[model samples]
Target: MSLMLGYLEDYAKNRRGSHNYHTILVMGYAVAGKPEFALQLFGRMRYQGIDLDVFAYHVLLNALVEGNYYDGVEAVSNQIKSRGFESEVTHSILIKSFCRKKEFDRAETYLRRVMEGEVKIKGGGYIVGALVDGLCKDEQFDRAGKLVDEFGEFHVYDIWIRELVRARKLDGAMEFLHKTRNVVQYVPDLFRYNTLIIRLLRENRLEEVCDLIIEMRESNIPPDELTMNTVLCFFCKGGMVDIALRLYDSRGQIGLSLSSMAFNYLMNTLCGDGSVVDAYRILKNALEQGYFPGVPTFSVLAHALCKLEKLDMMNELFHVALENNVVLSDRIHEIYIQALCRTGRVEDGYYIHGELNRLNKVTTGCAYNSLINGFIKSNRADIAVRLLIEMQEKGHTPSRQLFRTVIQSVCETENPEKQFQRLLEMQLSLHEIDCGVFNIFIEGAGLAKKPDLANEVYQMMKRSGISPNVTSDILLLRSYLRGEKVSDGLHFFHNILERRAIGRKVFNTLIIGLCKANKPDIALSYFTNIRAKEKTVRPSLECYEELIYVLCNHKRYDKILDVIDDLIDVGRPLSSFIGNNLLLHSLKDRELYDTWVDSRPPTELTQPESSHIWRLREVVGLFSDRFRDDISIDDLEQVVRNCFPLDIYTYNMLLRKLCAKQVDDADKLFDTLCPKGYEPNQWTYETMVHGFYKHGRKDHAKLLLKEMVQRGFRPSEVTSALL
Candidate 1:
């Protein structure tokens, strides 16, 4: 409008203006609804001794009325009347002026007066349509309906229903449509139905929307693009996928052009319904139609495709999103990257990850796990270790397992020292000078079995002017023991002992690591030495459990009984690992039971907390089904619960108890324990398989093996031999 006005003004300046130009200016401003400017132009035209023709005169008058300039309306209408510019147009404008002022009664009276005139206006329904619209705006729907009923004009009916729908009086509009449902010459057009259906769809009033859609088909009223899109969205929302697909498939025949909103809803609903193939097709078609679904819909589909391993399609969709400038969410990117790595496309995932880093997107810890592990599998351990360091710099803490995985990969690579040193340097440079950074390096090296590198990192920590904390000392000592360099561990132990830093946590580490490395003699030496000198200090439960485990593996039950005595004296309850280990071994070695019975001092039974040793004896006897009471399978788990917390390993022990003798009881126990929040492991399955096979129930054993394989577990050697 501004550009047109500028062009008009320029034309007037270049050519000495004429009356025609002046006339157009007046009418243009009037039709443009700028009554003030048009009226001002009117005054100028009069001053230049030019007057408006009837068309311009009526145009200016209507503009005043439409602008609600009542004072100007009265003045202009009086001038228009004096000039004898009166016609049906003048009367129509006058009636509209009355209605615009909310004078519906006066408007009706003027309408009657005009109808009585012999001028006989053609298409007079517009005059009544204006009155009905005003009445409806004033919330006088009763009066508006009455006027429409009396006039019975096609245009008035259209205005009445459209206004009623706009006013959210949908029931009243539908009721009025029902009243006029006589299949007459007049009926509401598809716009009114589209308005009603669109609103109902939004409100999830699917029943009413369905009814109206059927009504449209019955009335033979041709549906428009809006109606088509609304029906498509309606089907998707209503879970009417077949109908939606039928309609969508016939789009070319029906000339369907989808809007963006409908496109998004359809895509999201299709993905929700697990129709990813159909959704993929719709996505391609929508893109062809220049309709880009919303970011949420794109992510929903991306997740679906990734979950189903439709990687080729997912690859295409991801690039399509990027090319269209869709900002994929972090979760979407993470899953996509993981899927790519799972499909052996680590380099592609790496490129995407690099792009995310360049764009400063939040690369989550899970995504890094996938990429780091993926690169490890691809023989790119250097990159894997570097990414591990970079992840920590980006505020992600790799778990101990993750650190071990990367370090193990580094150990396998050529020139591992160079790779490890570079990664350590990157970690040290990016982090503050602290023992924690050094400890991570030391721990990683220890896990990789590089004790020399671990010691180098420890010395580097001291050289950097940072005091090594207790964790640093422990990790360093364990590195040597873990690398089987017991000589180095003993050397560090003497150094710490000379410096007077040997304490409870350090002694516990030595005992546990020595036991783990099969040097039970050294571990037992430290355990006894710590107990002798530091009477107040005792080994941790884990330290006792490790000693018991390695000793049991060595079949030294007398030493095991001595350890249990120390364990009871420590005032700690037996952990499931310790208890399960002792029980499973006693089942194999009859001497263990005899050792426990022989080693329990008669007076020690009277001591405080000595009942735990008695409980272990009872459990061993109970497993042999030699207890006094014949316990039911129901009592079996509860009895164990009274003794120790049941883990997967504990359940495996319990299953082993009945596997040989009471195989049915073992099967029942297996089925019942799962609902109590216990997940079965490979050994759990093996226990049941062995139990079934022991009872000559080969069919049950075969079934159990099949189930085990289905649950992602393969039978162990013993389990396979039983089958």
Candidate 2:
């Protein structure tokens, strides 16, 4: 690598003013995993004032990522921003590196930066896939899905389906696939179908696999070879060999080509279950069709023949493989050995194992574990243990499940402490202990009603340097709550608050718990604290409504009003039910009603129309005494003019008050409003007609009704009835 770099440097020095030299040099060094040297070359190029393009920046960023230098990746990313270069490749590199390092928060932050247009990174499937994979590994499945939705890119569905399958969320994967059928411009392709089908087959969900295939065909997506094989393998494993045969026979009709793996799997499954004649018939048909079976098919069939004690048929299959130029693989040898052991041919199994060992093909733990499991199942536990020891001596770590099995066997010996110690020892030896293991213990203890044990497990987790996640905190919280240790739960809640470890969900849970315990006061205090201190915590409407209802039940009207005020201040209105409850409670007391009215800021009211009507009613109530008394026209007019804005509605309202007091001045006020551009609506014309008729001026009333009709304003029904 150094020699290569030296040559590139010499070439760059000789080929001065050529940016391609430096760019090629950087790419070569990056691919070689010597990214630091690439970065040094980049700096030298920059020193020489060579113009760097987006590709050059992309190369440097990729080099930093290849070296796992995250900080350097960040620095180069910022430099890209500072230099006004927009390279999607650089952004994708940064995202991929952060996700690979499991720094998902940084990955998400960069994604959001790109989304918000702070960074000029174009969103595509590659960057989205990396972040989504990171999120799924972190068990943020829903968030990853939502991120895909926010980007609205259908190509990211492959990543989403794969992650769901990895998380064992096959149902969710299927649902997402079905949902994609409705998305504009996104057709569920064969790759997506195969991903879900493979997972379903692993889960033994053959019925669902069949249904999905039917659905795929209905949607016009013909099943491919992989799909057919997956379905056939599933049917074979489920002991429905007849269905597997029928599907294989109709492969051409289903638009699928028969593959060797599928053929081998079917033959092997049939022979292992004592259907040798059927397996031979399928093999004969395939060979007649001129299809050459590969090494796997040959190995499986040969092993199956050996299982049936048909050494002659097995040798014939081997000759066929030789004729077809098929070379046997290590996997084939392993399968043959396992088949021999399963048939109680231990001597032959050992012979194959020795031959493979001489050829260096028996080095994998899988081979050892296969024989070990076979011995254990055959009532030869002592031999299994011996093989396990030999496997370790060969520098192969036995399968994790092997240790688990041994520990289970020891646990059945009825020594709890010893069993736990052995389990821990195994974990230490294998370095496989993680928070998830402890979480299982904690969850089990909680379910078992042993909060003390759960707490101990939690402490062990902390001592092991495994910081608790939200799930861990929730498990411990649930333990405390279930044990009725309210104080401990409260303390844990405080710790979460202090560290800001809890999200809105935990805060809500805490609040709801307190409220359910009849501690509305405490719940309110926490809700207020969350609203004030944590900008991200948005308490649900249901939460606020529940607390308000509790406060109202307790007749804590002032506090209820405060909660409503805060909710409004944040532009979140209380629901109508809660708002009506507040109104009902306030109306019972004059002082409380006044306080509620004054608490709401003018801008926070519902809508302009409703607010206008409400204010008009309030104004009328304020002048109720004056209206009842025999106030003079001038005094009433002065009061209406001074207190209201004199819009059409207000003018109509004031005119109605005036008409009952002084009909002449009411007519004068109507005339004055018209000259001031306040045209009379239906209400205005109705009020005037009624006033004229009451004052024994029927002629004037008739004239006004005609004018009302001419102006396209109809009088009220009451006015027409009176006429």
Residue pairs with colliding backbones in model 1 are: none
TM-scores, one per candidate: 0.73, 0.39
Please write out the lDDT profile of model 2 over residues 142-227, one tens digit for every residue. 88888888775666777887778878898787777777766653666788778888888888888888888898888888888888
> Stretches of candidate 2 above 4 Å error?
1-19, 94-110, 118-130, 183-185, 273-277, 292-723
Candidate 1 RMSD to the correct structure? 6.4
TM-score of 1: 0.73
Best by TM-score: 1
Model 1: number of backbone collisions:
0
lDDT of each: 0.82, 0.70
Instruction: Itemize residue pairs with steric clashes in candidate 2.
Output: none
Top lDDT: which candidate number? Answer: 1
